[model samples]
Target: MSDPITPTPEPADADAGTYGPFAYLTAPNSVLYRRVMRVLMVEKERFTVHVRPEQVYAGVAVDGGDAVTEEAVGNALESLADGRWGNLLAFPDSSRVTAIEDFYRRRMLFQLSRAGEAAERALAQYDAALGTRGSLQSVALEDIVALLITLRHTVSEHATGATVDAALAHQTLRSLRERFVELADNAVAFMGSIQRTIDLHDADVEAFLAYKEQLVDYLERFINDLLVRGAAIAELLGSLDAASIDVLVTIAAEREAVDAAPGEAETAAASARQAWLRQWSGLTDWFVSTPARESEAKLLRARARSAIPALLAVVRALHEKAGGRTDRTHDFVTLARWFATLPADGDRHRLWRSAFGLTPVRHLSITAATEDAWASADLGNVTPWADAPPLEISPQLRRTGAYERRGKAVRVTDRSVAKALLVDRARQEAEQTAAARRRILTGGPKPLSAFGVLDPESFRLFLALLGDALAAMGPNPETAQVHTSDGELTVTLIRTPGSGVAVINTADGTLAGPDHLVDIASAVDEAAGDLVNWAAG
Candidate 1:
């Protein structure tokens, strides 16, 4: 440990100078003084009494430091006791001793004086101001309203004052002017405060809603009242005598009136009357001069009016936040809250696997075979990653960063067999279709008499032609067309009015009766429009 501050002589009867917060340590780079004060303050807090040098030193010094010298500690004590440097008082004491030699000897107990205490409190306030750096302090709407009412009353009172008594009028004019300045300055700061409050609390939905409620109440109380007061001020200004006052001559006369003897009553009364006029002139000159764009009342009225819409916007924003009907971020907040409700040690692994359609857990002992037969790990494999390309990683493996173990590929057992069978069946159907299409194209159109026998494909075509002929009897012919569902083939039907029946045989059955004579024409596409032209004609 270092050393304790030495005892100084008890304080003498000397007048002290004013000191502000931490004034003793306010010297240029007074690091030592500041540390001593902090230690003393802490000791006082812990013990709830005065601090002695020894207590101060024990708190200041760290363990395993160079031993503190007695002279250096003593100098700090002297500084605390000195009238110019210290804000503390050193009281002489005989009850306790710090050293073995002074066990029964006298010492000094030090405590902060009133000035020092005030300074320390000021320092705390300074720190608090730093923490919440002021956004223009809210102007009390009540204060402005009160000032305006009082000012209008003062102006009116001057008009009816005693001819020789200007004392109240003069004082009232000065007060009104000062209050108006304050109102204007604070009006600006108040607007800034509202804007800053909005920006700061925009994301804090609960606080913004709360503030909006209060702001609504605040505006409600003030807005209508401001309108009424502004009207009163304007009407009062119109009635005030703006022309019959001269300040310089009245000021000179008032001074002379103050010096007048008691016998010179008439002379004193005349000066007093002049002074009253001067007071009225001063009030009216500033508030209601000639050729003005906006009087003080008008400016104040505008301020009160503008504040309403700004306040409404803030309320509208808060209303939007409270009802999560518009903002996308509100949905995100809800999802985050749901995630937060999950237990810290919840079994998320199973949920994650099912949600993403993952395969059953597998071991790497039976890895899938690859086309490259040479793709095997090196002998010894001291560092497997040294020569390996980026691994074929599963999404789950990438997230968990698993390396020591891996999953085997899930075997697709039925897909290939099912796929091969579908391919063979489709190929057979396609070959038969190609053969049928070639016969239809080569034979172009056929009379019903020539169709003596029908193969499976041709019989299918005959059934389609029957459908077309029956559909042509519809009232809405535009919707009834002889085209396949995929629109690849168009069929045209003809009724030849023949005298005898025609017959055809197929492998499935014999379709024999259709002889009132029908001919069939087929076209594969719209470009081969033989059927389309025949249908149109």
Candidate 2:
């Protein structure tokens, strides 16, 4: 209903508001208004704002201070209680005439009305709004998950029926049982927290992602761990007579009996047996009975199993939230709707000013205290930053120089040890190289298979030698010895029948397939083994 262009705070009603008695607050001088209001706020309990001009300026007078006087304080008090500021009423709480008998004793007392209370509350609210507002932080699901996992592991270890000392078992059970209960309780609590986090206006996307992932991982892990423990427990429950861990059952039964006594003092053996019989109902409910109120261990497994799908559903909800266009914020969307329907130049201009505060800067001034303005208010020839050198059009421009590696030459703590390590590394390298060569040298000099089927490396070698042998066939079908450049090995090329000139595919033409053969042999060792690939190096 109000003008949006020049939006401002609603003015307090002059006749109806508490500030009516403190009308001097609207004075042109802000310091006096604030100081007087602060004094009232600080001493609101005192019925009389007993002002004495002498006491008001006592500290200032001690420092040889300024022009404050008794008349000034009295004038201020009178002005505050005047008919113009109708919110205050003057009164005397004195029983004796001596209350105002002397100038030093004379003081003004005033009580604030309903309007003053309202004004003070408004100011208090303004001050309070300056504090940091509460912000929503995404769920810390991973921490809870980690704690639950630790508790699960502890339960698993104890449930294995290891022969632990009685005291140790008691301590471990007490500690782990407390932690496990807390973790289980927190799992349910954390789901509510997840919903709260997702509902937040400014939820951290990265933190939410982490929380979602950790929670899903937690649920999956719980499902797996619970299944394993459940199977083990079920087996233990089903095969109590067949197990060698019967001591575990005996110890548990004893523990149950001791607990049923309802006191700290240990019962005698006969009394313990009586207690055990009395408490057999608990044991029956726990490990003996298969129906009607199953044991807590089975319930734990069931809850853990059920929680997986519940967590998965939560994850689906989170994903649905994440997989959407963040079109705009709520406040901005509302503002945009208002702007669309505003349809007025003045309203538009006011909206612009209110949104960005683009009104002219009022408090800035330029003074020639240090330096003069630029000589000309023009930038005709000014150029952006550049090197004096002309841009070169060459590969050198694209080139990058490699940095020299700088490493501190650490003194070897033990010279012999360093030398031994270096030698061992060298020996390892040499042996690896030699082993590759040995595999390549042996069993590779045999005749080419029918249809020229060869290993991948051997096929490459065939291609390279095919052209050379074909070029220098020299009109003879006898074997040709081609010594390699290094002459450490020799390749003997021999012609063989191709089973009546088989035709094969080729780039130039269908090849009259070669009958040439390659027999690999080391020059120094006639009985060399299969060729090693390292020899090609």
Candidate 3:
């Protein structure tokens, strides 16, 4: 337990100060005042609502030590009273007075004020939130499912004219909402913590590596639970009609409406119902899928799945680090130290050459006779250059530091014939492709069956366009449209109800599929038509 807060001088009245109830927190003696208030608050919790000045002194003295005098404690208590910061309520302790001398002392008691208690609660919650690393509570999900089932059954009973417990219904709904809130908040926090863990920020490398095996398993288990249990939850949510949900909301709201002010029962009920309905809507959306969006459950599962790979990547990195691989930076540092200890500049230069081998060797200009002798010799043993015969260097290389070959320059080959053939072949292919594209687009929008018999070139082009459109269509879209890879044409495929298969004859084979409404139009711009044609080629 901590000590209470210090106090300031009492104001003329409870409302005299312009400061709020927590104003003592910023005062010069705020520490002492907070200690005094904490003592009062703790005593209040223990059913000692009104604390005496001596009690406050004893509590403050625990942490403050002898530095906190009785006079200081009394002054701190008075400063926190209703007249000053309104952190405490001052009461006359007449029951303790025994004689005229005791009466003159004016024994008083201190209790925490409503504003003061609210401020303390806020501070306590702030501290808790700051420190909390929330978790993934799969049990919370189970509890939520159970609550929803209970509510569903209760609503059904109420609908069929069966006796129902309103209080139980309200309590169950409240508990369900709270549990859901905790689950969502904890899951988000846990996922965030996992990311930080993966980054290895502030984590012990060895410990994290040891813990990661279990962490990965934990995430995997949670993902499995979510997938299995999430589906059941979504099913339950879908089975409950809006009217049934509204009935339960109404029951919970009416039960709470009793707390409203006089003559405001109807208004309170309506507000509570609206609030409950909004919460219910959020709950439904969290589990049930809509046309425009996937449920949060699916998204959470995807995030968890992605984290598994990331964790493995981190583990791989850690393993590499632990493999005792040589570091480039460390090698450079060691090399620098070796260089630093050298006694001579020439030795340093030689060490640098031996270490890097960046210096060029100039003895490659050997004569034809010498090269033949060196190649034919059975030379396996090492021979220092100092003990070997000198190489025959060319005069030009010795003078200019470069070898000059003694020969005529090679003649450049003529490629104009090959270039002309390639150009002609590309032109012919481009012409054929453009003709095929035009033949398909010229027909405009028509049923797939009406395309009739297409030439091989046109059929290939048609297949390419159809493949692009279908790829854009995804799983079960009613219609899909896409520009060709060359952006010279746009193809659209729209499925129709009760459509039959369409077969198109080609020289190579036949193609068959749903007789969809197919449309291919030229999408080329006049400015970029040349570019598009070149790309097609």
Candidate 4:
């Protein structure tokens, strides 16, 4: 008979060996022995069952720095099938499998690196979907909530698995967090886009509905992640409580109220009711509102003030809807009272100005009648209308020819009037110009002749004439100065120890110095003769 066939014992009883989720080894030679033996013995069966053992054995043999034999290969296959290599393949065991796992982990990291681009594409798709009217037709708050849930689930799953290093692990977690945040942000952005598009489409009711859907989506997530999460997240969520929900609710309710109306009167009544509801709702909605930080409070206040124009616009809309006319004077007084009670020096100024219709004055004009009345009135008797003259002329004025005046009174036509006005205007303009000039002149620490407005050429000419005249004088020099007063002109010369120079000043002066003075005098004499010649012509 052929040698008794020693059937390969089934893998189950081959090791009767203990196994664990992770692998380990003994000690000393166990370190190297287990590392070599684990891949050679334990992994062989799994590899041979799928493919050739030699193919898998080649990698282990190379790593173990050994030559493989058929017996060794068979033993490795048997041990792997029996699961007896307990401590041998433990995570502590640095083997080719660990390297393979590392390779795959790196690959996952590379995939994750592209996640941002994927998210961007997803966001673009979402935005495109929102832009279409058909996509919004049956969309509801529940749909957005469902989408968020899906996103959260997908991100959470992707974060799992030990296939990443510490750095990659942290990156993965951060990516997940950012993805959730982006989802929330995108939901908000999509809602806003939808609302804007609807508003442009002139579907106010639809726009309001879209806004309500956004609020519901945001508030649900806010309440869930913030209120249900750990204490830290809860605290963070609580910080967002200051956001005014009533504004959104009021907008929706107003639209609903108007849409539900059967007639104009009913619409008006509904609008009035909505207004009252909004006022109370606004107060109640913010009752628990507190900023997380002083800076946040400051920012909120600034933003609130910035929104005053929008608030007033809404109020005006509601007023019109209610068929109630706005009384500007009453509104101004009401606003003034409100502003007076506000905390000083916050963002209240902008709101206060808006509410009171306080606008920058572009131009101002005082009528002649108003000016005259102001002139006649005593300061102690001044009132709002104190400068407003009575329309009807007084009987005393009729007898005085005040009513029969052909044109403006002599007081208005006096030459002194124009002169005084001109002088006053000129003085004001001159003061302004001088102020600017002074600023430019004093801009630097030291003064320079270049800062002066005098033309360089003119100054050079005057200096040259002075130098020429000084040279003409004797060694003990005389300096002459010329000046004009009113219509008269004068030239004077004085001798100085160092030099003698001549200066000339003219009423309509073109040049200065002794040379110019002599030339000008000669020209005047010549002109007198020319005048006679021209008269003869």
Candidate 5:
């Protein structure tokens, strides 16, 4: 083996000739250059750092077929090792030379340079990003909650002047930030991919349906998890006092700044503290709602819910495509099949005429006299055009080309009575609905069990309010508040601690569930203009 090639320092900008780690990517012989580097890198992984030119030629020939030759591989390796490109470190294979003539041959062993390896890895990462179909990570949410809880305890201990472990604080903060970033990024990516899937125009029907079904289920599961964890995270964040949080932030910053230079420790700590505060702000804004706008968690949930209807619409379109009610193509195909089954030319011609009715009508000028004469006559298929009797034409039609008497113009029907009845019925129903709202709002906030018996309309309105509140909450929530879709009522439900079930008797049946303190109020002040009159008929 010859001595390893000693790398030299890169030349100045003007002398470097614009060559870089990625220079070979745009070169005319980039394909062959990449293949040579690939073979060398693969060999390097196997602890064969130095590869003979013949081995490289063999690998390149296999992957690139008849395009690569031994001479071509040698030339590419030499070009890559030159001072300009510098993608490989070349060594002479002097041990294989038996005679001086053999020495004259440019036999060399090649090893991939550091820059070349880094470029390959970067390209590999790029390819992976292109193929990635990101997913909603519920586990990340769980991890974030766990971290916040730990930090809260840590802050409480520090507040009481207890010694805190700086290393642990740093690690916890780092991990929390990392997990939060992963959650936010993956959610954005997942939602984007879902939009693409929904906008699929030419996808196979069966395949798209299967994917969309599973996608909807996945979204629902994630949304539920998001609601529960998001609320918990927001509450935890609010529970931490600003002073306690500052203590933890300082501890983490000091821990991070330990690696800084002696004179720069204070400056580094200040920078780290600022960075930590910024990250905390980001985390807080993601889960905590404000007066300016809603939290990202709630927005993501709404987007996910909207996606369900869009997916259903696509499914409906696919269903229509598979089995349409008025399929003209099917009709034409069936008619063609019928024409194909006919035996004789005459029979086919007759079937075509009967189906289309587009035959010439030169002898069809009928008059009242001819119509009476032919009333008892046989004009069947056996009668040809030449044998058929002639029909008389009216003298007025021949002279003026018109033979009908004029009549009076028709009057438009009057629907005032029907319109009045519809208006009266609508007014009555709206009054009834208003009465139900008033009845429910009479007894302020109380335990569900105290609501007593209810009319059917009141019972239905109560159920609707209950459903809206529960849906706004997660699968298992202790307290929830929501405004009905009609913007007329706001409902709040709080689960009370007990083993008793709240029983509500309606005119139809008795309803029982976990006892909850329920409150229903009119949203007239907040949504006066947007209120909708929800009436059941």
Candidate 6:
């Protein structure tokens, strides 16, 4: 107030010529004011500052360049502890400080308040800078935006106080705004790059999902085809078993021998004598007409009568050759009587014609006793033979004549009889040939049931499914084919050709693959174990 309190000169190291309230406070004559300005400037930069009436007095004394004790500093600090300094610094009207002393006091208070707020804000900004120092280089776009907002606030706050130099404030705000703008641009660029990366990742993942779905579908179809093919092989084997042919060689040999005999004269005469007896006996007996009777009565009687004599003669010859009893003779009367009573007109005559050297005749009525009797009587089997009774013939000859007895006549001819036998034999041969053909064509068993086995349509579906699987497996060049036991199924794997890789099945035709035979066997065993457990459950 007095003489405007001119301050002392500034130190040589001070930045520039002082201006405003600080200029008056530092004049050489106003030692107190000069010391006060020095204390205020130094303290404001170093430690926390409080401005009160008592602290203001201390500041004026310290301005005289006197050394202030620790107690003095403490008293000054305590005096400014209340909030009066804050009110003065915040005074709304800038025109209130008319004098130099008033300007000095008011400006000092304003500088202190503004410096404190700037220091606090600077400290916060420094901490923020330290916390995000590395982050500014690598932080996301959102974090950069947040940092810019804080920086803007800090610059604005620092610009508010009148105590701060107008030029310094302008410079700081300009620099801060420039920094914020640069950071915001960098953040925008960073966000755009990150979004692009995310878009690429999404596209790749979607493609992978579609590929996986296709792969699964292919695998399912492949397995189904393998199973169907295996079943087809099994069905084929069954058909083969049903059609095997078995030839009766013994019957064929007997037929050959009968075809080899000599002359129509002796054969016809022997046939006529046998025909007459067959007609008379068949009319007399019903029981003797059956097939059972032919074997028991006619065949046994024939054997007893004809074969026994030869067998006895051979035994006699052998016994004589061995120097043993040769006089042991078999009773021929029992054999002769059995033959005499047999149904002459029965199937026995046809059997006799087949057994003896006689030409076979048509319409011989060998099917039943009554028919045979009528046929034999008409052909004359009911009458006696004119010359010798018919002699026993070789076992090779087959019966082949019609008989006449009394005035009845039965005509016997080779042509008609041969045709009937040929037709009968043809039927038998055809059946045998067809059965053999079926056996060869169908493997071994009967055809599978309509629904139980895989049909042609199902097989086609299986092929399609297998084709899909092969495509999904990515064009394997190797391949393998296998047949099932029943000769029905044929399984094929489409794989990398010439590659060692292959798909195979178990001996029982179960699907197995992706490994060697040994590995497939092991896998099958494991699968069987699982099946057993499932069955128990």
Reference-based lDDT, residue 243, model 6: 16
Tell me the deviation in Å of residue 91 in model 2: 50
lDDT: worst 10-residue window of model 6 = 242-251
Scored against the true structure, residue 71 in model 5 reaches a CA lDDT of 85
Q: For candidate 1, give the lDDT of residue 246.
A: 40
Off by more than 4 A, model 3: 1-36, 57-86, 89-108, 200-202, 323-537
Candidate 5 similarity to native, TM-score = 0.62
Q: For residues 1-537, could you state the per-residue lDDT of candidate 2 as single tens digits?
A: 321122122235544634465466676643443444445554465654543334433433343434455565446545655656654445543433353343334344554544655666677787665442321111222332343344334345556954445454434334433444444455555444544654652456557556666756765566555444444434443443323223333443456456554563345434544543444333223323253455644454456555556645655666666797344586688888888998786787778789879675444332343114323333222333352222332343235432222498778586888899999999987676445334334344444434333344444444555556555554344667665456655566677643234443334334444344556666756534334534655
What Cα-based lDDT does every candidate model obtain? 0.56, 0.48, 0.82, 0.40, 0.81, 0.38
Candidate 4: worst 10 consecutive residues by lDDT? 106-115
Ordered from best to worst lDDT, the candidate numbers read: 3, 5, 1, 2, 4, 6
Scored against the true structure, residue 86 in model 1 reaches a CA lDDT of 53
State the RMSD for candidate 1: 30.1
Q: Which prediction has the highest lDDT against the true structure?
A: 3
5 or 6, greater by TM-score: 5
What digit string (tens of lDDT, one per residue) describes model 5 on residues 1-537? 444434564433423333376788898988777777778778888999788888888889888545866888888888988866667777777788788677777667777777666767777688788888788999999999999998998887787888887788878999999999989988888889989887874477778987877888998898878877887899999998788778878988988789999899999999999999898988888998887788888899889889889988988877887785557888889999998999887788798898888875754467677777667777766678776666677777789886654498679999999999999999999999999888888446788888889999999988888887778775456789898777778888887855366789988999976677888888885454344433321
Compared with the true structure, what per-residue lDDT tens digits does model 1 show for residues 1-537?
334446454344333444533556666535666666666666666764777777667766753444565556556766866767555777666566557667445477788765665566676677665554222112433443444455445545545662433554445455554655555555555656666765676667677666776765665555555445544554455654443234323533565577678888568858676665665454444345345344554454455456567767777776775686566677667756755676653434434444455644354222244213225644232446555544344555557755454488778666888889999999999888767655454244455556666688967866775677657734223223366555556555544432345666779987644343343334455456767799899
RMSD of each: 30.1, 30.6, 14.8, 35.9, 11.1, 55.0
Better of 1 and 3 by lDDT: 3
Q: What TM-score, over all chains together, does every model reach? A: 0.34, 0.23, 0.57, 0.19, 0.62, 0.13
Error of 5 at 353 (Å): 21
Best by TM-score: 5
Q: lDDT value for candidate 4?
A: 0.40
Q: Which ten-residue region of model 5 has the weakest summed lDDT?
A: 528-537
